[model samples]
Target: MYQLNLARSLAAGSVFGQNAVKCSQMLVSEGKLEPESFNIAIGVAAKMRGQANLRAFHEHYLEKTSEFRANKVVRRFQEAIDSLSIGSLGNILVEARTTRIRPTTRSTGLDEGVRL
Candidate 1:
């Protein structure tokens, strides 16, 4: 169930390119998904979106290896990191936030002496 949701979030983020980081962060840190999934999801997000800093990601993952090493379930985590670490991530296009402006409304009250 958790894996399914993680994949769903990754897929949605990859395709839509919105909430990718938030979804990835939630899934990776709290969803309890596989460590490899974390790497893969973050990698895809970085490629699809911007990873901010690949160097930081690599360092953080490497630091976690020893902690997860005892558990054999996360062996593939290294592979995911390796795949994401290859070459430059290339340029990233960030979508700009749009602001909506409300139309101004004027009301002429009984106090017409004041400007509307």
Candidate 2:
């Protein structure tokens, strides 16, 4: 469960997301992780990195598992793929960047001009 959560977190990251998905797949293949964990991680990767980025992973998983199509996450992902036009599929990064809200820094109680 810990590893699964870690994989999900990594899958949500922009830089290491693809590698995390690949590693999750490898772990499943090696019996180090559950198949469901791989599904969850891949689903997150597909959502965060976009379906285009994870297409190879999707294809490989589909080829390897008869149950791939039946998984709810994979089913929704397939639905999303089918419903979206090609152009919209490329907007995941743009959407992510545009929608993010940055936190504001809080002022310390000390004097404003004093160096810490």
By lDDT, the best candidate is 2
RMSD of each: 17.0, 15.9
Q: What residue runs in model 2 are displaced by over 4 Å at the alpha carbon?
A: 1-70, 91-101, 105-116
**1-116 per-residue lDDT for model 1 (tens digits):** 46556656666735434444454556667765664554544445555433344444555666777544433323454444446442222111232356799886676677665553
Name model 1 segments beyond 4 Å from true.
Answer: 1-32, 50-116
Give RMSD (Å) of candidate 1 vs. truth: 17.0
* Model 2 pairs whose backbones collide: none
lDDT of 2 by residue, 71-102 (tens): 54566766766675433443442244645787
Worst 10 residues of 2 by lDDT: 85-94
Q: What is residue 15's positional error in candidate 2, in angstroms?
A: 13
